[model samples]
Structure formats: C-alpha cells, structure tokens
Target: MSVALPACPSCQSEDVVKNGRTRHGKQNYKCRDCGRQFVENPQWRIISEETKGIIDRLLLEKLPLAGIARALQISELWLQQYVNQKYKLLEREVQVRPKPKSRLRVQMDELWSFVDHQGNKQWVWLALDAQTREIVGVHIGNRSAASAQALWQSMPPVYRQCAVIYSDFWSAYELVLPSKRHHAVGKETGKTSYIERFNCTLRQRISRLVRKTLSFSKKLDNHIGAIWLFIHHYNASLPANSSCPL
Candidate 1:
C-alpha cells in the first residue's frame, strides 16, 4: 500500500511534506519542488453578500475604517481593499436629472479639508440646484480659478447657459462664472445657503471630511471617490417628483 500527499497550491506538485501545524491547528504542507507551502482542503475566505450589504451601509456612515473593521469582525486590510475596489468602479460624472426650464437658480460653495497631512489642503467645490436640492456639479482641488473653472465646466450645458449662479465673494467665482449670471453675495444674505448647508451634511456623513478627525484619507483618489459615492447615493434617494429625467 502507498500513501499520497496533497499537491502544492502554488506549483501543483505532489512532492509535499508535512511541515507544521498552523496556529489554528490546520495541517500545513511544504512543497519541496517549488518551495511552496499551503494547507490541504483549506477553507477559502469569502465575503458573503449579506456581509457586503452590511459593509455598504456602514460605509455611508461617519465611521472610521478601523472602527468599521472592529464592528464587523473583519480585518482592516480586507476592508481597505474592498473600499479601494469600490472607489475604482465609481463613475466620475455626476448623475443628475435634466431640467428644460431656463433661469434655474444654483448655489455654489467650497468645502475645506486635508488629506494625509494637515498642510495638504484640498478644497471640494460644489454646485447645488435650488429647485430640487440636488448636487449638480463637483470639483476637488486647490481653491483657485482653475478649479472653479473645472466646476463650471462640470455642470450640464443647460445650467451653464441659463442658470443664475449665487456664490460667496470667492475671487475664483468672479474669474470663472459668467459675469452676467453670477452674483457674488455675502453669506449673511443667504444666497448660497443651500450649498453651504449641504457642506455640513457632507461633514456629518463622511468621516474623512470631519474636522480634526483621525479618520483622514491617505490618498486623494480615495477621498474624491468617497465623496462621489455618497453624492450618487444622495441623488438616487431624492424624491421621484423632484427629479426630471432626460
């Protein structure tokens, strides 16, 4: 009678020897041919659909990555990888309904935040539709005229051409927005109140955006992606009567 050993997972070689037991007491094998080590009948790790659903809900909350990991009983590394994957799949363009009405009112504002270090400042420029309270355009970058131009270009053509814009006395708005349609006003006047209020909503929901928080973003892409993810969810959750589908 002959005894057989399991093949190596990496090299698929049957020339394997029992090396030692894993910390969990699983039988571990080492392949002499490829120097590969693995266990037989290893239970492959899988993130269940139910677990993913929980993760999705958690991500929308103002929770830190480590906090979320601890709450879910999952490794932080796995949760980070999952979050990165979700960010990569996100669409860059904002999803918004088209409005045929001309002279729609728009409120614009910029939110201040930093990534990795406090010195590395990143500004989130936003445009909100006054009629439906939907975020219509967004740009993330330095507080400069170029970024303001990017925000202006991000909006649908209907807004760019016909909408009346209200913003704070930020010089960038004067440089980018159409002079005839743009109205730079003081916050006390409440012209840009909608966008300003939405900024508070973002900070409340996003941990990375919260001031003086330990849950800061390490990468700019992830930071932008997280904001976009929330914006998409926010837009989709709006009342059906509010959005005008194209």
Candidate 2:
C-alpha cells in the first residue's frame, strides 16, 4: 500500500519531496517544479473580514503594531504582512478636482523623518490646495532641490502652471520654484499656516511620525505608504465636491 503526498501549496504541483523537519518537528517539503518549500499541514490563520476592518481603523490611529496585534489577538508577523499588502496596493496619485485657468494658491512644506535609524533621514514634501484644504501633491526624499522639483512635478499640471506656491525661506524652494509664482514667507506671515497645521495633524495621527516615539518605521516603503494611505482617507472624509475620488 502507498500513501499519497501533499501537493505544493504555492503552485499546486504534485512533484514534491520530503526535505526535512522544521524546528518544531513538523514535516517540511520542497517542490521541484516551483522550487518552493513549506511545512506540511501548516496551521494558517484566516483573518476574518471584520478583523481586517478593525485593523484598518487601527492603522489610521496613533497605535503601534504591537499594540494593534495584541488588541486584535493576531500575531505580529501576520499583522505586518497584512499591512504590507494593503500599502503595496495603494493608489499613487492624489485625487482632486482640477481648477484650471483659475488663480489658485498652494501651501508647500517639508517635514523630516527617518527610517530604521536616525541617520537614514527622509524628507516628506507636500503641496496643499489653499482653498480646498486638500493635499494635492507629495514626494518623499532627501531635503534637496531635486526633491522640491519632484514635488512640483508630482502636482497636477493645472496647479503646477497656475498655482502660486507659498513656502518657507528654504533655499531649495528658491532653487526649484519659479520666481514669478513662488513666495517664501516667514511663519509670522501666516501664508503657510495651513500646511503647518496639517503637518502637526500628521504627526499626531501617525504613530511612526510622532516625535520622541519608539514606534519608528523599519522600512522606508512602509513609512511612505502609511502617509499616502492617511492622505487618501483624509481627502475622502472631507466635504463632498472638495476633491475627486480615485
């Protein structure tokens, strides 16, 4: 009598062989066709839709991954994997109504953050539509003229051509922004108060961005993704007709 072997979980290939035992003495197998290895009869937890929805809400709040996992009774590894998948599929473009041929004012600002360690500094550049209070553009990179230019290029074409940009006296703004449409003002002038307040909101809501916090991001991609995710949620929650939806 012969017993049938389990097929490969990844490719569903039957060309599999027993490789070895896992550290916990579970049977491990390797697939010849897909070169994939997995444990036999592995216990996989199925996250319920309700649990996933709860996780989504927690992600937008000022909570750490460990705290979220603990509260949801899920493993940290699984929660991290879920978050990775969620962020990877986020839309890259900001959804907003185009106000072409109109005199629009935009507030531009840059905030500093780090990934993995303090040495790996990353600057988050943002452009906000003054009237709509929508985050119309974003670029994550070093604090340089190239990043400023990238932020400008990321804005919708109409805003880029017609919007008057108000920012601080950062030399990069002077180097990249058009002198005719750019105004570098001090904080006392109140020109950039909108973006400044939004930055404060960002730090308050995103745990990883909170100053003096131990919950800093370990990867740059996830850090940037979290910010964009919150931006989309915020724009969606605004009054109707404020912006287009993606």
Clash pairs of candidate 1? Answer: none
Put down candidate 2 lDDT per residue, 27-46, tens digits, no spaces: 88999999999987676668
Whole-structure CA lDDT of model 2:
0.90
- Local distance difference test, each candidate: 0.90, 0.90
State every prediction's TM-score relative to the real structure.
Answer: 0.83, 0.81
Shift of residue 39 alpha carbon in model 2, Å: 15
For each candidate in turn, give its C-alpha RMSD to the true structure in angstroms.
5.4, 6.7
User: For residues 1-246, what per-residue lDDT tens digits would candidate 1 score against the true structure?
Assistant: 877989887888888899999998998889999998888776546779999999988888899989998897888899999999999999988788778967799999999999999999999999999888889999999999999999999998889989999999899999989899999999899888878889998999999999989999999999998999899988888886663311
**Best candidate (score: TM-score):** 1
